[model samples]
Target: MKIVILGGLGNLGSQLAQTLERDHELSVFDRVDFDVLDENALLNILKDIRPDILINCVAYNAVDNCEDKKLYETALALNCELPARLAQLALQFNFLLIHYSTDYVFNGLETKKEFSENDTPNPINKYGESKFLGEREILKQAENGLKYYLIRTSKLFGPQGGSPQAKPSFFDIMFKLSQDNKELTVVNEELSCFTYTPDLAAATARLISSKAVYGIYHLINEGAVTWYEGALELFQLLKQKVAVRPIRSEDLTRPARRPKFSVLQNNKVKKLRPYQEALREYLNNL
Candidate 1:
């Protein structure tokens, strides 16, 4: 199968490219290669390549920055418009469209039950709003005979990607901070799952290969934790004795409102291993 991956040089995209290349013919494009919003160019590529699958990984995911109204349009463009266009093309080209979403789409209120895929999104921030709308855009295309897989994951942590704009993962940020400061502060609120890119890539490959029912799926590492807990685990793994302190979400001066408990429950597919296992491997490799 010929698979075309947009934003292929970024963190998750790069992992997907690495995981999928072994079994499929792959073509990857990132911001450095061309403007992904160029419809004419994209259509031409679609026409020429006639890929079996089209995967879109591009997103304006600077959560706090997305609150700026000046950047909101860019967020809408990348998160909503682009994927909708790709879904349209997928319908025309008779190819499967694979897109990723986030756990932030939920309200994140405290709950004993994990969030299943059936729950309607009530995003609390501009970034989540954009992503939620993006999911709806693709589903709108789905209503018009588009085959798609919208997978939602959270708190990604792994190797850095090739793009200049690519930000380090949450765990990576914590690791870096530990080097400079003995005492690090992380939010104890906003408890959510952390996804390992390699694990997510593997699960995605399985989903694609199986051609499972096309709708929404939650793919994430198998644990729910807060930023403070995650930071503690990361330090414990690296044998770093950094003094980590807990802070509330309200205490932090951020532009976006975070969900208090946005843990995704993966009910549709085979579950991945625990985040601790994945994180251990990631640290060992590093």
Candidate 2:
């Protein structure tokens, strides 16, 4: 299959490119190659490539920065408008649309309960709202004969390092702080699945190749943990004695409201390994 991966230089996209390229004809385009907000350019590229699958990894995912009113348009353009246009193009060009979403679509209030695909979305922040809107746009296109797959995930980490064009991930920050032997404080109140990019990339390849049911699915590692726990595990894996502290989300006072528990339940495709196993594999690769 011929695949076109947008945001192909980023963490998840990079892994997808690496995993899928083994069996598929792959063409990658990052923001430097073409702005996702540029509808004309995007359509032109899709027309030129004419891939069998268009996997969209592009997103404006600066969670705190997304709360700024001045950046609302930018967020909407990348998170919602881009996917909608891509869905339109998929419909026009007869290609499968695979788009990534977030667990932030949920309110994150149910700590003990896991969120399923059937749960209704009630995003609490602008970032979540925009992502939810993007999902809706894709579904709307589906209603008009667009073949699409929406994969909602959370707490992504990988061996590929942080996205150069985006903010560093939590794992990156914690690992860097460990090297300095400085005390690191991570939020313990929030809970979600920590996904490894390579595992996700593998599962994605299976789903698309198998021609599974075309709808929303949650793709993440099997278990769930808080940021503090994940950080501790990372330090232990590296055999580094870094003093780590646990703090509440409110104590940090971030610009955006985060869901306290947004762990996703993968019901459709359960090919991903456990979070700890995936993390260990990533560490071994490093």
Candidate 3:
């Protein structure tokens, strides 16, 4: 199978591309090569490659920045419009389009229960709203003879991505803060699964192979933890001496409001593998 990954230089895209490259013919496109907002370039790439699978990893992922930007115009263009158009092209060519979504679609009100595919989306911020809009557009296009998959993941981190320096992810940020003896404060009130990029890529391979199940699927590592707890664990693993303090979400003033508890239920994807085992393996590698 031939696969093309948009935003291929990003953490998840790069990992997925390399992982699949061993088994399948893989071509990756990053912002430097192709712009999602550039419709002509996108169309040309789609036509030239005519890939069997199109994995769209491109996204305007800055959570708080979305609040200040022209929410719909900036984010919707890439998130909703371009993907909708791409989905149409995929349908025309009888190609499979795998689009990535987010767990922020939920409002985090349902704390006791893990969010499932059956749950309704109620995004609380512009970022989440834009992502949900993209999902809607792609699903609508898929409805008309387009084969597609919307894999929703949360808290993605991975090895040196496309960056020359290969800086750390959020977890790495916490790790560095601890290493520097800086005071680290994380929001304990909020909870989520800190998914590793390698794990997500492996599961994505299985998902594309299964291709049997379609629509929205939640994919995350096992063992959900709060931001503070996650930092503490990572610090523990690194043997770093950073004091991690817990705080409430309200303590931080941000442009956008994140879901208080956006723990994605991976039972749908867990059938592919035992997530606990996968999580342990990833952490061990780290």
TM-score of each: 0.98, 0.95, 0.92
Identify the candidate with maximal TM-score. 1
Q: Which candidate gets the maximum lDDT versus the true structure?
A: 1
Would you list the rank order by lDDT, best first? 1, 2, 3
Better of 1 and 2 by lDDT: 1
> In model 1, what lDDT does residue 55 have?
88
Tell me the tens digit of each residue's lDDT in model 1 across 47-162: 99999999898999999989999899999999999998998899899999999999989987756578999988989999999999999999898888888999999999888888
C-alpha RMSD of candidate 3: 2.3
lDDT of 2 by residue, 97-117 (tens): 999999999998755688988
Candidate 2 TM-score over all chains jointly: 0.95
Off by over 4 Å in 2: 161-163
What lDDT, from 0 to 1, does candidate 2 have?
0.88
Model 1 segments beyond 4 Å from truth? 110-112
TM-score of 1: 0.98
